[model samples]
Structure formats: C-alpha cells, structure tokens
Target: MRGQEMEHVLEAEGLGKRYGARWALRDCALRLPTGRIAALVGPNGSGKTTLLHLAVGLLRPDAGAVRVFGETPYENTTALADIGFVAQNTPVYRDFTADELVRMGGKVNRRWDATLARTRLAQAGIPPHTPAGKLSGGQRAQVALALALAKRPRLLLLDEPVASLDPLARREFLQSLMGSVAESGTTVLLSSHILADLERSCDFLVVLQAGQVHLTGAVEDIVAAHQQLVGPRHHGEPIDGVATVVRARHTDRQSTLVVRTDGPVTDPAWTVHELSLEDLILAYLAGSDTQSNHEAWGVAA
Candidate 1:
C-alpha cells in the first residue's frame, strides 16, 4: 500500500535488526491504527524491545522502515514531537525532586503540559519535594509516567513500563495508562511479559515468536478464530478443515488439540472450547513443538 493512503498510526514493514551475527528481530510488519492500545507480547528473546525502540526512533531497522503519523520517526523532529516514550529504564535525574522534574519537562520538550504532570502526581499522592532516587520502584514508575503524559503526545510507546511494580502497583499503573488514553484519545503501544496485564488493558494484541510475528489483530477476533479441540487419537491424516493445530495432547483413548481455526467447529466427534488470553499466549510461546507424537501446526498468514 502507498504510504499516503495508509491510515495506520504506526507502520513497520519487513523490519529486521541484528547485532554482529545474532538476529534481534526479523520480518516484522505492523499496521497499528489510531487511538487504540496494542500489546507487543513475546517470550524473553522475541525482540519486543527491539521493535519498540525502532518504532520510537531510538533505533533504526537494518532491512525495513517504520513510520509514525505518516513520517519517518528517526530524526524527524515533528514526528518525535508527537510521540511520548517511556523506556524500560526511565530517563530521570536521581537527585531531582518531582518539582524539579516538572521544571525540566518545561525546559526540554516543546509540547510539555505542566498542569497535567502536576495533576497526575497529585492524584498519585506523590509529593513534589521527594527526591526521585528515594522513591519506591512503583512510585518511580508513576513519576516517569507522569512526565511522559506531560508531553500530551499523540502516541505513547512504553517498553516494559510495569516490570518492577508489585501487583497492586501494577494494577494502578495500568489503570492510570488506560485512564489517560480514554481521556485524551492517545494511541498506545506497550510491551509487557505479563499476559494478564495485557489481556485486561489492551484491545489489540501482537504476538512475536523467534523474531517473527505469529499473530496481530483485535483481541476479540483472535479469540474467536482459535479453539481447543478434544477427540479420539488418529493416524497420519491432517484434520479435515482446521486452520492450524497449535498443540496436541493424547491419552490412550483420546487426543486433544488446541487449534486456530477459521470460523468455528461443526464436527460432532470433536468438542470445541474457547481459549482464554493466557491460553492463546501459551500456544504462541510453545511455538510448534515437534517433540510431541501428536501434530502441532501453525497456518501461514
């Protein structure tokens, strides 16, 4: 598709990155729409952070291109102005107080909204006089979020933003992020290892496995297209019309499989069960396990 005709807020086409001979990301493609939260999910080595860094202009792709708001993100001042990024390790002055941090935002970013920063800090019960380094990990995360929101950005790119928080704090942080998106129509792309967090907070999901995109779409649509099937064991014939057998299990009399099928099940011999977000996530992580005597497959997109 032509760049000007695309409606995506963020676009990546055949993106790849490598360090020496080790591949960090490969064949990555995304067309993210506006005003929605997208979860960049994967296992530890699956390149979520690499994709995010490229999207935010902190890193460049070796083989492809990324565009944000119809323009290249790297070194594009106007595009950068519209993006707010909170890296895994937030950029903060350890010795600075909340008040000083707010002031720093004013002096640095052209789009800074001092009022929003202050209001968020106040709501979180974070004292302006507290030194940034002295705050708890959760508190520090909140402060970083406040600063990011202070820019009033059109898009927010967060890389493992809640990694260090406790359950309660993580909940609060996610709530805050969702609230901000609802209030301002911000487009958010966040990466997280926590499946439950993404399931609850994001409407759109992307699953990356071994540097390739396994699936990407609305959460509801993905759930609807996948199912767990249970039936008696069989020999070498492929399932009649199933999309892809994601995983399989067997007892002496029965064989059960998780499959991503087009539409739904109609056969009487097999029973279909809806998959949870967590189940879907695990299916992707297991990634075509061949050791099982049963067949596990992935349909090509």
Candidate 2:
C-alpha cells in the first residue's frame, strides 16, 4: 500500500493566513493522497487548526491557495461537499438529540447515510434520544464523528478530536475512527498533540512549526530518511550525505544531531540510531525556530 499511487485528496500551495500583526501560517504546503490516514503534528499555536480551516474553506487563505480533489475549496460547493470536518470542540446543538443530529446531517449533505450514522451511534452505546449537550465528552465526540461519517465524504478533517477525552475514551474513539476509515476508504487528515495515538493511527505525517511546514511525507519514508547521530563534540560542520540538519545538541564531550538524508550514514565515528515518530516530531519542533525552504518529501502534490 505504501508504494501504490493514489490521487491527491488535499493540496496546499504556498498557503498563508494572518491575524492582523501575526501570521498564523506562512508558506505552508502539503499533499494528502487518498486512502491514507495522515497525522498533522505541531505544538500549540503552530497553525495546525489554521491549516485545517483553510483546507475546509472555513477560513480563506491570505496568500496562495488550497484545493480539494483538484478543485479550489472556497465557495465551491462540489469541493465543500467532498469534505467533512469536525472542529476541536466537537460542537453539537445542546437541545438536539442524537437522532436529530443525524437527521440534520441528512438534510445538509447530499450523500448522507442515515443508517450508517444510526449504526455507529448504537455501536458506541449512545442512545438515539439523548440530547447532544447531555452526552459525555466521549459520547459527544462519537456523535460528532458519526455525523461526519454519515456524510460519506471523500476527505474527513478532524482537529484535535480526542483532546478532551480520557484514555479509555480516546482508545474507543480512535478505534471507531479507524474502523470507519477502513470500511469507507475515506482519506483522513487529523490534527492532535497525542503522539502515541498518532503513532498508532497514522501512516502519513505532516509537521508544522512556527507557521511553516517542517516535514510532510509517508511516515515510513520519513523515518527511513532521517537518523540520529551522537558523537564527540567538535566544530559544528555540515556532514556529507546529510540533506538537512533537523536538530542538533552539543555537550563538552558529545554532540548529537538529527538529520534528514537520502542514503545511509557511512561514518563510523558517530553512533547512528533510529528515531520513533515521537522522537522525529520533537526534533523537528525543537528546531522550529530555524528558517529554511519548504520541501514535501515522499508524496508530491
């Protein structure tokens, strides 16, 4: 599946957004292919939410453009209809029952599947007549997700969907989510701070930091392309075969650097180690302050 060619479901080119004096996102770009679960990782205020909004047309870009399935999203009904988005808060009407929300989804979306929504709610143990506001955080999230899934959208966007749930609830929510994705083959772009969950749920990764795209690619390719090296401290000179130095640390006797490269590290002086998703993410986030040209590695737009 990793080598299979798929259509690009979402594409952002030189995207930017600003709030008066501050640019929340700038020169950001990424391509999410169909049929893969992509994790969007960044620290607070790194513009994860901003980027999601831009993709869904909830907010327009101040620069560049974003497209969904090759069409611009803003005010484009076809493009909008292809996407289902659940915000960070997992919003639902307080007075509306779970059944009503499902009905509402049917009314709003041309392709809504009422049976799917009902079945998902039942599977989650959420009663049909329970008012959304009366539901627990986990239940609310489930309902929100059900509503999104019922739309039968080609692309689903979730922003920190499990941030407020407990560990058990988080597990259940993600399980339901992955199950839905598997059955529907929907392309998903999810943003969250839960590294462990992301590591388990996603195959593709996009790391944003300080308003820029630091890394974007298939998780497997990204991991294979980067390595962590620890060795004796010396003048910080560039290493051959290393494409980009993601992060570096130096002590009196030892130096450590996380680097992106296309080939193996042949030097014997440095101890090379593999990096987990969490390790790679943190290393990129730690180097967020540095400036460089944006590059989308494994998957091209």
Cα distance off (Å), candidate 2, residue 205:
0.6
Estimate candidate 1's alpha-carbon lDDT, on a 0 to 1 scale. 0.86
Per residue, candidate 1 scores C-alpha lDDT tens digits across 3-35 of 554457998899899988978999888989887
Worst 10-residue lDDT window for candidate 2 reads 291-300
**Which regions of candidate 1 fall more than 4 Å away from where they truly are?**
1-6, 234-236, 288-301
TM-score of each: 0.92, 0.92
Q: How many steric clashes between backbone atoms does each model show? A: 0, 0
lDDT of 2 by residue, 1-301 (tens): 5233347888899999999989999998888988999999999999999999999988989999988888778778888888899999899998999999999888888888999999999999998997999999999999999998888988999999999999999999999999999988999999999999999999999998888998999999999999999888947676767888888888989989999986777878888999998999999888854334333343333
Task: Provide the lowest-lDDT 10-residue window in model 1.
Answer: 292-301
RMSD of 2: 6.6
State how far residue 74 of model 1 sits from its true place (Å).
Answer: 1.4
